[model samples]
Each structure stands twice: as structure tokens, then as C-alpha cells.
Target: MDMNEIREIFFQECEEQLAELETGLLKLNDGDRDPETVNAVFRAVHSIKGGAGAFALDDLVAFAHVFETTLDCVRSGKLEPSQDVLKVMLKSADVLADLTNAARDGGTVDESRSRALVKELEALANGEQPAAHAAPEPVAAKPAVAAAPAPTDSSGFQPIPFSFDDFGGEEEEVLMVAPTYSVTFKPRAELFSKGNEAALLLRDLSRIGEMSIHCHTGDVPTLDRMDPEGSYLSWTISIKTEKGEEGIRSVFEFAEWDCELDIKLAEEAEADDERPMIPVPFDLSLLEDEPVIGDEPHVEMHVEPVVAAAVAAAETATGVMQAAAAASARAEKKEAPAASAAAQANAANAANAAGQTIRVDLDRVDRLINLVGELVINQAMLSQSVIENDNNGTSSINMGLEELQQLTREIQDSVMAIRAQPVKPVFQRMARTVREIADITGKSVRLITEGENTEVDKTVIDKLAEPLTHMIRNAVDHGLEMPEKRIAAGKNPEGTVRLTAKHRSGRIVIELTDDGAGINREKVRQKAIDNDLITADANLSDEEIDNLIFHAGFSTADKVSDLSGRGVGMDVVKRSIQALGGRISIQSKPGQGSTFSMSLPLTLAVLDGMVVTVAGQTLVVPLTAIVETLQPEAAAIHSFGATQRLISIRNSFCPLVDVGRILNFRAQQANPVEGVALLVESEGGGQRALMVDAIQGQRQVVIKSLEANYMHVPGIAAATILGDGRVALILDVDAVVGASRGQSLRQEMSLAS
Candidate 1:
């Protein structure tokens, strides 16, 4: 092990701790305050602080110390989380990320921000700042130590006394217990610098216990490859101690992060001492032909049947005497059934065993998806070849090829499933955002999540966080109304923000709805004009005006506030959704609330699209947006205004646009209504009939980002590879429809002349 290895462990533990802190934050603000959440927050901060102390990161330790103090107050119910407290905690999280990054980089972090946050936290803690520059009395400090006995050099196993088989595998276990209890502990990456040693701690504990040691050498590097500074070995030890649980826990009071330690009482020490003929060593280099404790011979006398019967009779007599001596014996035995039932119920409360979480290296999942994407391409080619060969009467190869195609398709689906993750974590994050916004806006908001287990690609899930957080906050601060306003409107005192996720038509749709005051159309329009997002006299539909908020710095907040007057968050949300090759739309009524729906492709690597030609240029349109394709008569194209082309489709007059003109591509003709009309529907309840040269059928295409290769082109969501190996830009139907509407309005005004 080397510095790089240590760095990796530090980064990994930092991520896990951050996730725990985030989950705790969500639970903290889940409307109902749970003491467990505060304890969780405290534990998370404590772990980080301990880890930082071991790494000799004074800045990190100091910052986390303050954070832990504040959380301790919450844990003890001395201070409930107010908006101010949450803000400080959020800043503390930011500091932790910075400190972890700094430690990994072998540098120090700026202490100014952390000090400011600590000052605010302390203010709330004591209702004032510590008496100006007064030196406080030092409290009694416990000896910092590793949770477990130190592993001998070049050993790999950490010692634990408990038989953990009864507790199940090494997954979720309660780590925070009262003090003085012993736990076999392993400190995370940087714990050694904190002046803690497993050996020293074990030695101190031997005052109360008889101890034996063994080291696991599996993780030890070769002598020539070993780094003196790195901890490569873990240990397993057997200890008999009289100290209560808290006393044992105190040994590892300052070292827990990144380390894996397990502890259990030594109940069979006598049996262990009597059984083994060979003695396990206390140090390494005696690894060859090491003592095998379980294989050693133990004396077992075979008893005659009569002798066994007599011993059994004596044991029965002793049992009867004990039962008769204890009056509570029968009562206890009577409660045996209930006790067993109670134990069974306790088992159920341990935790849900059903995949609470699964960890996968993201790079591996991405590689699998990339391979699946290539398979999809090859499958398309095979299908095409099979169709051509079948038409040519090659029956034998066609049947085999068809089977191969099906298997390949199934394999692709299976690979995609590996990258799918439930979006519950994302929804939970949104619940916290709602709390934040409610506090900021002086409103009451309750979050209700539906279909939280809806699965999507990891890539989509990653990109969705920012956008969803912003949207949820927007719904609370801007979409929801004040408590008085809600009460006046005969609504519940607490407004509801519903965050839902579902799969529809081969895509994931996330909807954030708020039962607050709906979008004030006049205010949005007026703000749009003031911000130069729209002309003062411009007449816009509610949908169009509502979208202006997504424009940078287009907030309708009357004044700058803590929440969102800064105006960067919503714009970021819109851009992030767009970057994921998704469309976001808003729907609102005057009195009712608003719904922000984001429809995202399941995977960014591949998609099903319909190929259409516009002015001889092939373009791919997502099949999800296409309702139907029609070959309309030329006479069916009617002019509502100078620029608005209307086509009668399914007995309704729908606006028609030349796809080439919308994309700013070369237009061969204006009225190509007889060619092909794609009846595309936008997310914002608008319909557009796009005119193209021809329909080239539907096929799955590999999606390549325009942003990766070139700048993002407006009206183009992404570019994909056609079957013929040509590049086709996918039409952003929503943006194109909006553009067409704008053009139609301008043309109609000109036509009045």
C-alpha cells in the first residue's frame, strides 16, 4: 500500500459519510422530527471528525467539532432544527467536502468559510458568541484509540470477539452505542496520525481482560513493495474483559471512519483453551503451516447406554429441583412461547434485507452499457440483413439470424437493467429541498413522493439531482403560497409538493407538482418583460410565459431573499435536463398549483428514433414524441396567418411547420404537405405537424451528444447514427413548436397589412 491507496480509501469513506449525512438531512426535515435522524447526523459528523483527526487535518477536525456540537444539541432535543440551523448544517456539509478534497490532495483548506459557519452555529448553540476571546476550561479528554487490537505487521484480518454469524453479514449494523463497552474497531485511512494504535489500546484493555492475538497477512504487500506509512494488515483477537460496553467503546472514541471493526464477547474461552493442540502466533513470518485450531484433537469419551441413561436421569432430577426452587420458573416457561414470538418480531425490526442499497463501481456499469449499445447497433445491422435475406428466400439463415437478433436484444435489455437504479434517493433529496424552500419563503410545505422506486439509468439519475432539487425548491418558494393565503382559499394549512417518478412510453417522467398558489401569469409576464425576456407588448400563452422563468436571472421574486432571488438555480435545472436529452415543461392554472414535468430518455447511450428527411438532410426524431405519421394532401395545408401552416389531422386543425425551416437548414420547398407529416406533440400541451420529405421507418440509434462534439445547436436535442452510418440531428420538438408559434404570430400581424 502507498499514498495512492490511502488516498483512495479516504475518498471512498468521504463519499459514504456524505451520503449518510445527506440521508440524515432528508430525514431531519421530513416534517416529523425523529431523534434517530439527529443521532444519525451526529454520528456522521463524529465519524468525519475522528477520521480527520487521525489524518492530522486540524482544520477539518476543528470544523467538524463545531458541527458535531450543534448536532449534539439536536440529538439531545436542546435545539430543534430551524431554518438558521439547517443553513449552517448545509454549509457544514460544503466544508466537509472541501476538507476531504483538501486532505486527499495533501493540502490545507482555507479556514475562513468554516470559521464563519462555526461562528453562526455557535451563536445558535449558546444564544451568543463565546465570551469575547475568553479561553475556556478544557474538558477531560479520553484516550484516542483504534476500536480493535492492532494487527501484527503484514497481517490482514481485524480481530473481533463476537460470533457475527448470528448478526448476519457485514452490511448495516448499529455502530453507535453507549460508552465503556468494547468493540473491535478498524480505523479508516488516516486514523494512525491521530495517535491511536490497536496494539496499545488492546494492551490497555488487558488490565481488565486476558487477551490472545493473531494477525491476517493476506493484505500485506511484499517487503520490497511495502510502504512504512501505509497500514496493510488487519487483525483478529480474542479478549476477555470486565469493562461494560461503553468502556470498550471509549477506546475507539476517536477512530471509526473508513475502518471496519467487529466485536463480540468471548463466551467460549474455556472451550477454546481446551481444544487446540497447536498455538496461534502473535506475530507474522510464522505463516507457514500455521496452527489450525479447529483441526486439533479434543478428548471425547464414549459413554455406555446405561451410563448415559443414569446421567440423563440425574440431569432431569437437577432440573426438577431448580424448577421447584424458583417460583418464577413456571411463569417464565409459560412466557417462553411469547418470548420466542417476541424474538421473532425483533428479527423483523432489524432491517429490511431486500436490497436497501447495492454498490456497483460506476465505471463497470458504464462499460456494460457501452457494450450493450454496440450490441444494439450490431443487432440492428443483423435485423436489416435478415430482412433482406428473407425477402431473397434464404430461409435457413434467416431463422437463425432472427433468433440471434432476439437473444441480442434480450442481452441488451439485461445489460441496461444493470445500470438502472431506483430514484428514491433523488426523491428523498427533493424532500429536503422542499423543507429548505418552505423555510425560506415562510410557508408550510409537505412532500409526497410516488413511485419512488422507479428505475432509470445511473447517468440519468446523476444528472437529475440538480434539476430536481431546483424544481422542488421552486415549487415550494415560488409555486406554493403563504399559509394565510392557503387558509383563505379553503386549503390545508400546509401546502403539498408532490414529487413523483414513473415510466411512460419507454421513458422516465418525473413530475414535481405543488398545491400552492398557481403561477401568477401577469406577474410572470411582467417580469419577463422587465428582464427583456419578452417584448413589453408581446402576447404570450401561459405556457410560454411560464417557461421564461427558466431563462437565466428571470426570477419573479419581488426582492432578493435567502432562497432563490439569485436566479441561477432554475436556469441550471433547465440546462441540466436539456443536457440529458430531455424535455421539461410547466403547466399551471391561475388558482390551482403548477406541475413541472421532465421527460427523460431512459439511457443517454441509445434510443429508438424515427428517421425523417428534411430538405435532403436526414434527421432523427425521438419516436416517443411522434403520435402518428400521415401523407396529407397538398390542399390539406391551410394558412391561418402569413406564416402559420395548418393541417387537418384526425379531424383537428394542427399547426404545421417545415422541419428544414425550423432547423435553419436548406428548404427545397415551402409546401411539401404531400410528402410526410409527423404529428408530433410537445410536452407543454402543444401540437405541431412537422412536414418532412419522407418517412424512413423506426430504428434504435446510438445517441451521440452534440455538446461533446460541437456546440449545442438550438432545436436539436442530440445527434444519432443512422443505419447507413450517417449523422442525424434529433429534433427538439418542444423548442421547434415554440419557435413555430412565435413565427406564426409575427406573420399573422404582418398579414394584416
Candidate 2:
């Protein structure tokens, strides 16, 4: 691949490292004192800095270097990860992400913001209290790379020489005598499970210099009693290499987190070196197959019995036998190399398959989804055609069609899952939002996120960010109380905003909650009146008052704040959700808290729907929208207002909406008693009974966007093709309810009256 492609991979890796950085820092903030967490956080920054330095991204490398240095202090336990320190590190992570994004996308970074963060990082590195809040003069821009830089390309990317200091020390000077060192490595189960092999690690180490490795197999149990997956083997090595200890450590860097490793000068670990160890020569085919450069080949000694015992012991303990029999055959150096070629080839292919991954273009995936959708529609059409034509007993064709339908559904589900990704990235972003908003509002706030790993389609996740961001901003700015206010209310000084996501009832639910002063019912009521959203004497319940925040043109704030109210208020949040085939609701307890729950479909491709007919026109209602369906009773119908009607169910009277009149499918409302009523939960947390002429069988249908092809209709969500090859509209239930309450159905009732 070319440098541009390599840079793209680098950027992709940067995202993973940034995620690790954020997760580790969050753990630190939660009072986790695990050393590995600190190391992971440091490694993430170091990796970014190293990559940045290679491209001579001076600004990025500089910021990441200082940030890494501050993290190093935490790793070494020279600095405590107090909430203050973690706060600065979290901000640094955000800046690092921004810098990386700018570099990858050719965008501009905020010099002022980065400069301020650099100051804080420097302060923390110097063992001083981090005054990162002060926007002091930015430190001078300097390349974090130490080695000489090569000539620059047209893209301004200059490759910097790789440095050995990252491992431990400089390797520029060669010693007269290679330094002898002792290494004791103990493998944990995680090492092998993570696709790391101790044999491979040993192979890399043996090439560094002249080395003798002794395998310890005393921990191994008998074959039947031993756990195949358990790690029961370890190795000790004595080496004299001019490359120094740094080179040795670099060999095992990938497995360091999964294994117990120790490296010291021979003099220091001489006592631990006294243990008896089996001479498991690194020259074995599996462990030391490759010939090391600069070393002369040794004459093979006829020590078959010793080699056999060692191979068996190692194989039994490690369980990493890529080619155990082939290795055994190769133990006799006189054996023909061709004897093991077939086995070796098969083993190599298996190894490659274990770690192979391919990155496909997202546009290609989208096209595949489109094709699968067409396949589903055509399959439905074919099945319908076959059933209608078959008067004879063609059970074979029927069985084939049944199998085909099942297979088609499987393919559709599998294709849609390819576009599914966890919502962690979006939730991680909310951390920064909470911090920035809290700073602006001058309130101490803590954000706790759970269920971030809940998966949803890429389309939903992409649009989800904007609305989720707005809600997070509002939760911190509006839902959370100030520090002093929380303290006075017998709560912790730090207000908390919690974000969670989960799959529920064939949809994804994202709930944002805050432990602070909730919606003030009286205040919200008066604000609704002032905004002309409701009548002055409107006997609104607390829930109704709470939901009025999402009413268009309504504002509880005297003036718009720079935080959540940057002018796309809760109303826009609600509209954006509705546009995504989703709905948002609110539940609040005065002086306690408020929760904003958004339920959205998993994918935009196929929807499970309840097919129905209204005014002789076919319509499909999203199954997720319908709570239950029932035949309305004549005794349960009651008139409301001058035009609207209500349906009484379970001692509760819910507004009954005529689906036909609301969509203008018919001029008059459908009789409630003669029609099927689908009880659906509306956007504002109220139930609406929708009257349809009849209930048809349920089926899975592909959603075809109307706005993309035709003009956007008010009460129509989208259109779909039916099994019999007819177009049917998908009813936007919430939109129809709104229309029924305000305009069309009431107008029809008035006209009929």
C-alpha cells in the first residue's frame, strides 16, 4: 500500500488508541488504581505521538508528547489521578483527538484551546497543581521527534527516523562487549487467547543476539487432568547482545499486558536464575525455525531422546501446537524439509485466518443492503404469485418457498448487522459535552455512562449524535443543579448526569437522566401559557407540564443560554427524533430529577409492521409503535370537545384518532366501534387509539424514503411495496396523532356536524 493508505490506517488506529485513552482515564477518574490502566492510557498517547512524529505533524506530536509525559507521571505514581488531574487529562484527550482529526482530515485545530491544555499538561508534568483552566501562553511549537528527518514530500510529510529510546535507552552507541541479561517470562492465559504465542515471542528474541532459552515445564499436569487452555509453560533466557535490554523488551511489547515479564542485568537476577530448567533449545522447528542473521549455523547433534522429551513437554504445556507433528519430525535435523511442507502450509494458512480482517467501503455495504432489500421484495412477490397460481397440490414448491423466505430474512438480518456498531463513541463524546457545559454553567457535574455497548445501525448512530448531544447539553445545563444548590438540597456537591442505552421491544432506547432539580411544574405551566402553547387556565398535570418543554416556540429559560439553548432547543430534538422513526418522552419528579428516553428503530432498512387498511387504502404501522390492538366496543366510545372523540380502556380515556380522516384518505371519520383500534404511545407520553378499517396480517417490509423520491407528506412516514405488488404508505403514527389533535380529523368532524 501507498503512504496515503498507510496514513489512513494510522488514523484508524488513532481512533482505537483514543478510545482506550478515554476509557482508561474514565477508570482512573472512578478511583481505579490499577497500574495497567495507567500504562494503557500512557501507551495510547505514546502510540499517537509516535505516529504523529513519523509524519512530522509538529503541532500534534508536541501536544501528544507533553500529554504522554503527564500520563507518565501517573504511571510512575509520581502524580495522583485525583479528580482534578483526571479532569485535565480528559481535556487533553479531547484535544489530542481533535489534533489527530485535523491531521487526518486536513482541518484546523483550535490553537488557543490546545495551547491552554499544553500548559496544564506541563504543569502536571512538573508535579504542580494543574491550573489548566488558565489560558496561559502556549509553549513554543517543537517537533517531538529526535532523530534526523528525511526530505519532505509534496504533501509536507517528512518521515522521521525511528528511535529506540521509547523502549528504554539510546541504541546509537555499540558496546565493545555485548551486555548479558536475564529474562523470566511467565505466560498468562490471556496471552495465548489474544493471538500471541510465547514461541513467536521467543523467536523474535533469539534473533536479537546469541541467546540460550530454557523452558520450564514443572507447572504442567498430566494430559487428561490438564486444562488445554491453561498456561503452564514459561521460559528463562540468558543473552549477550549489543542491542541492550531495550531490544529484548521490544520483542515482547505486544504480549506485555497479557504476561508476567522481568528483565534485569545478569548480576541482579542471578538468584532467580538458579532454578533447574529443561534445556529446550530455541532451535526447535516451532520455537526457533528461522535462521538468525549474523550467526553461524551449528552442526546438529544427534540428541533425539533429549529433543523428543523437550518437544513433548513444551507441546503439552503451551497448547500452541501449530504443527506439533511436523516439529517432531523436524527434530531430527537429517530429516527431509519436504516431509513437513504440506503440514507447514496448512498450519500457516490457519494462522493467517485467525487474524485476517478486511476493511470494506461503507458505500459498498449500503449498496449491498439495497440489493438485499430488493431481493426481499422480489421474494415476497414471487411467493405471492406462486400461492395464487397453484390450484394443484404442489407441496414441494410450497416447501421451497418457505425455505426461501426464511433464508431471505436471514440474509437481510445479516446484512443489516454489518452496519451495526456500538454507541460507545457517541457516549464518549457526551463526556466532553458535559464538561464543557458544566464549565460554562459553573456547576460541578459528573457524567456516568452505561450500556454504551448497545449496538444500533450506522445510520441511526450518525443522526443520533446531534439529538443526543443537544439532550446531554440540556441535562447538564438545565437538569443539573449548581454545586451549592445541590449541597443545600442534601446531595453531593457534584451533580451527575447518567446516559444509558439498551435494546427494548425491537427498538433501541437511549435514556439520559440527571440527579438535580427537575422540571418545575408550576414554572413550566406558566411558561407554556406565556408561550401560547397551552391555555392560561389549562389544568395540566405534572407530566403534561414537563413535556411542554418540547412544544414548538416554548421556552422555560428567560433567554437562550449558550449551552443547550444555542437555539436548536428541545423542540428541534423532538422533531429530529420523529424524523428518525423514533419518539422521545420525559418523566420528572419535582426537586428530584428528570429522564429523557428516546426509543428508535434498530435499522432503517427493514421494518416489522402491522399491515392494515384504512378507507380502502393499505397502510403499514410500525410494530414498535403499536402497544396493542383491539376491536373498539360501542360502549367505550365517548365524544370529546366539539369534534374529537375518546376511547375508554381499563378505566382510562385515551384520545381516539381516526386514521382515515387524518390522512385525508376519506372525508369522514371511521366509526370507532366497527374498526380496529391500535393503541400507540405518542411523543408526549400519552396514549392515542388509532381507528383503522381492518387489521391485515403482519409482515416485514423494506422502508423506501418518500422525501428522497417524492415530496415529503405530513402524516406519511414512507412508502413500501406489498406482496401483491402494490404500493402502500407507512403511517407516521405520531405525525397522524398530531394532525388529528390539531387540524384534519377535527376539521372533518366539524364539516360532518
Candidate 3:
């Protein structure tokens, strides 16, 4: 709508382009030699450079210009995209992102970082290996790329050479003479609309050699009839460069599809120049001023004499003739509206069939979700009211209530789905994090991500980065042994860390596993004792000992380091996960490795749950955790210890956990035979029978965070409002199951087996 709005849109597009750039570079790093990938990477930087030039973002344009050059070499196969090459490119992408942010938000990036990257990129383009760490020096300000004039020596001396081609070339003179080419680029409106700039294109051509560009305006229409979207401008460029027509055409490679581009040897196009044309030659001398040398002509006219017969007709105009003409004109105007309406209808239908989308602000979607949550509550309340007042008779009111329930649930789900987004961007950031950690620790590590496209709530995704990043740093710094240690342990020198996400039940499970020397139980136990977190003689299972690292102020590192030993990482990770209504667990092997698994809800807004009464207190068990509900018979219940019990189903025994006692709703365990047994699964591949007093039917309820609204309860995940407007606790199935096990979970599990 306006310049500022358009600039903001350009910056928004820069973010997408930056993401694509990183993705394509990562593909190349992963040994993908697909030509399209290289092309895509090149186009991203090129697009940024073009857009930056449009807004006069000099630093961005300069850096992207240099970055794009190296990528061009890679795209054209002039330079091989080896591991080292990609490493440089990845860092360059980071710098480019910083530059973009700086352009948008008004800040400065590290001059040293940008300057060093510029030098390395330049060296790579020149077919030289980049230094591991190039020192930064005082570099020129980001230049506004345009048709730069010929270079001069440091002494400011310019060289002048004369070509004697007209008199026939001598052998010595011909060797020094460069071939010339003529290029005509007439851009359609698509070019400008798509963020490509004509000035930037001409500037790219100028890089090849000395060039003169002409602005052709003969096709421009008069102001009254002119279309703002029309394409009436064209450019004819004449250049003499050492690299011939091939080099010249490469400048327009990115724009070939959106513009009419033709390139040929200068002599081949000499005949076309003879046609009479209005050309405005661009002056390259004034780099600080506009390149165009003339104002645009808005209108043109041609004069002719009026005929005598026309004047005679006007003097004798009749009423019948005027009436007939008016009627005819009115009829023509009346028909136009019907045809126009039909065309508009057809366009609308085509768009609907295509299923196009518009971007809505996130705050609006959030408001919609809140409204939908209110709608769900109201629907439930209405249903509850009808059940209490109506008799056991069939009625249309009952049927209508059923229909309304289904529709409301669907609307809530649809609204929540709007906030769902892929976790790939976070995973990509983790890759960068891995790279940074690897550099810091000097460890040869490979990060493998799976199911990065798994979609989750945007809120969950936003908070996931911190915890994921901490885990990644721990995996690299403490989980993975150094290269020499890995080799000594009969493992690959480069340790592998695999991060994966998948939907399990109704939750998204993210597991981070590493291949290296696993957790050392002896060291961990010793550290726990030293930190006074556990008694020296305390007996703990391997799982318990391994989990000690998650305790506050506990670190197994021999000495303090930048990555760890601060005793805050894993604990912070645990707390952050807990804050999101998620649970995390750890499993480790002596020599193999360790795996940390996190289970989180798909959306924090609402969840399906089974409403049950525990010790006269209403509680909800998440539907996702329940495998099946069964009534435990006296024959199936058996006591393992004085207070421990197990329920046998289909020849398998699962621990029996009383929801009432576990949640402190009652002082004693509930009767298993008289009540319903919910067979629920936990994240660690364990099943338990949760005993509840009575079943109150299943319902979808909006999740209000207990910790946020009130305080955290050990076995209760969150709080929700019931149809009767009573507050009920949502059971944290994993926490309850885990608490039932206590220290004897492993021993009881072994006994059951």
C-alpha cells in the first residue's frame, strides 16, 4: 500500500529466502550434488541482493553481492562445493541474516565477522582456500553496487588503450583486445513485482567490464490511459569484457524467465541498432545520483486539420439523431455490467478451486482460539443442563444438542490447527548450534535430525529451542567423548547425535540419542554425593543415578568449562519442559550411549480427557495416555508386597496405581475390583492400571495451566473447568505412574516379569 509497507514485506521475504539458503546449503553439505539445489542457493542470495538494492541497503547489497559470487562459481561448477566450501557458505548465510536483520531493525553486526567473511568469500571465488580464521581489518563501508567505472592503480593512474580493429588486427594487438557484446533486457511487469530490480541487473552486467546501458521509452503510453502495472521500459546494454558473451549472459540467468533477454556478439546486433529509437544512455560517473539522465515523457500528440463536412453535420444536429445515439450508448453500457460480473465470478471460482491462502496475524488467530475455547465450554454447559432437566424421552432438542457438540468440537480443533507449524526451523537452528558447539569443544560430531517436519503448536515450537539447544550442547560437550576417546572405545571417531520427533498417541515425542561413551554411573553417583544431593551409602537404580544430573547444582564434569559444570543446563531443561506441561526421561547404557526422550502435547489449548471421580474429587485422565478401560476382577488382582499390587490382563501383569492415593485425593488406596481400571501407557514404554472411584464420561476440555494460574501439583499436569463449573485436576499419568513405582519400580517390574 505504501513505501514502508512494501519495505516491510521485502524484509519478511528476506526471512524466507534466508531459510531457503540455509536449507539448500545444508543439502549441499550433506553430499547432495543436485544442480537444482545449487541453483536455489544462488537464487536466494541473488534475491536478497536485488531487494536490498531497491531499498538502498548498501551493506546488505555489498555483502550479498560478494556472497552470491562464490555461490555462482559453485552453481556453474567452476568451484567445487566441498565440505570446507559449504562451511564458509553456511557462515556467510549467517552473516547475510544478520545483515538483513540489521537492515530491518536498525542495528550493527560485528564488523570483524562480516569483514572476515567477505574476504574468505572473495578468496573462495578466486579459487583459493580460505584461511581458518582471517583477521579483520578496516574495510570499506558496504558499497552500493552499480555500474562502476574502470579501475585505477593505487597512485590514481588510469590506463588508456586504443584498438586498431578497423584497420585489421595485428597478432599482438588482438591478444590484448577484449570481445564486445550487446544485451537487450526488456522486463515484463512480473520482474518488478517479484522483487527483481532493473538497476541491480544492469549493475551485475557492469561487473563483467566497461558497459553503457540505454533506457528505451518509446512504448510508454499517455498519462490518462497509462496502466500502473504496464511494462513499457527496456534496456539495451553494450559491454566490452575479457569474458565474452557467456559471461555477459550469466548476469541475467536469474531473471531470464521474467524478462526478454537477448545476448549476442556486438557485430551480430549492429543491424538492429540502425532502426530509429529514443535511447537515454545511463551515466556511470555520478554513483551518488540517479543513473537516468532524462525525465520521462508522459504524453505525446499529433495535429490534423478538421474536415468541412464534420462542421456542417454539427450545425444541423437533430433531436431524433441525438435520441437514437443516446439510446444506443445506454444499451451498450447496460450490457457491459453483465459481462463484467460473469468474468469476476469465474475468477473467484478459479481461486477457490486453487485453494489459495492469505496470511493472517498471529494475534488474531490467538483471539479466535480463545473465543473457540469459550464456545466449547458453553456447549458443554448447555449439554449438561439438558441432561439434568430432560427425562428419558427422544426429542429434537436432544438431537440438536448432539449436532451442536460435534460442530463446536470441530471448530475448536480447526482454530487450534491454525497455530500449528513445523519444527524444522528449530531443528535447523539446532544444526547451527551443533556446529557452534563442535567448534568450541573441538569435537568431531554429526547431528542427524529426523521428522523435523513434525508439526506442533507454534507456542510449543517457540519455547522448544532453549531446551533443545541446552540438550544439544550437553550431548556434544558431555555426552560425546572426544575423537581420541571415541576411537579408543572402539567407536567411530566422529560421534553421532540423532535428534528425532514423531507423533505418539496424541503427543509429539522428541528423542535425542547420541553414539559415544555413555553415562558413567560411578562418576555420576560420586558427583551426586559430592554435591550432597544424595547420601554416599544411598542405594539407587541406574535410572535414578542417571537422572541425578537433572538435579540442581549437580555436574559430573571434572572441572568447570564453558559448556557445562555450571550445574544449570539439565535442570533448566527439565524445568522448562515442565513449564510446558511436558515430561522428560533418560535412559543410558554403560558403553553405547544415552537417550533423552521428551513427550509434549500437540496443542496447549485443549485436550480430550476421561472425566473420573477420585476420592470424591473430580479429576481428568488424558485420553491419549489411556489404552483401554477395564474393570478389575478379584481374580486378576494380586499383591506383590504389603502395599504393592499388580493387575494381570491377558497373561501380562502391569503395576496397579491408585489415582486417588497418588494425587493425595485420599489417604488410602482405592478398591481396584469395585472401581474402573484405566490401562494407561507412559513415555518409558510402561503400562499401569490407574484405579478411579467412578467414571464420569469422556469430554474435550480447555487446558488451563495449573502452574500459570495457580501452583504446580506433583501428579496433576493442569487444571480444567467441568460442565458444572467446578475445577478439576488433569492427571499427569506419567507422573502418577512414576510416583507409584518410587525406588522399587525396577524390582517390582522384574518380579512381575
Pick the TM-score winner.
3
lDDT score for candidate 2 against the true structure: 0.70
Q: Score every model by TM-score.
A: 0.57, 0.69, 0.75
- In candidate 3, position 750 carries an lDDT of 26
Ranking by TM-score: 3, 2, 1
Q: Model 3 Cα RMSD, Å?
A: 14.8
Better of 1 and 2 by TM-score: 2
- For every candidate in turn, the CA RMSD to the true structure comes to 17.0, 14.1, 14.8
Q: For candidate 3, write residues 1-753 as lDDT tens digits.
A: 344544565676677789899889989988999987986787678667655654557788788878876887676566899988888898899889988999999999999999999999989877643442121121113231222232333433221111111111111111227887788889886775665656556655655665555545456544333343446657676777887777877887778899999888888989877332221122211221211101100010000001111111111121112322332454446422111122122222222222246557888998898888888888889889888888874678889999999999889878888899999989888888888899899998888889989999998999999999999999999889999988898889988999999999999999999986789899999987887877989989888888878777778777898888778788888888887888899989877999999999999999999999888889999999999999899999999989999999999999888888876668887779889999999998488888998899999998898877776667778998888898888988877888887833333222112
Candidate closest to the true structure, highest lDDT: 3
Error of 2 at 538 (Å): 4.7
Over 4 Å off in model 2, which ranges? 128-354, 392-397, 521-541, 551-554, 559-561, 564-566, 625-658, 661-691, 710-715, 733-753
lDDT of 2 by residue, 301-340 (tens): 1111111112233333333222333334354453422212
The Cα RMSD in angstroms, rounded to one decimal, for candidate 2 relative to the true structure is 14.1
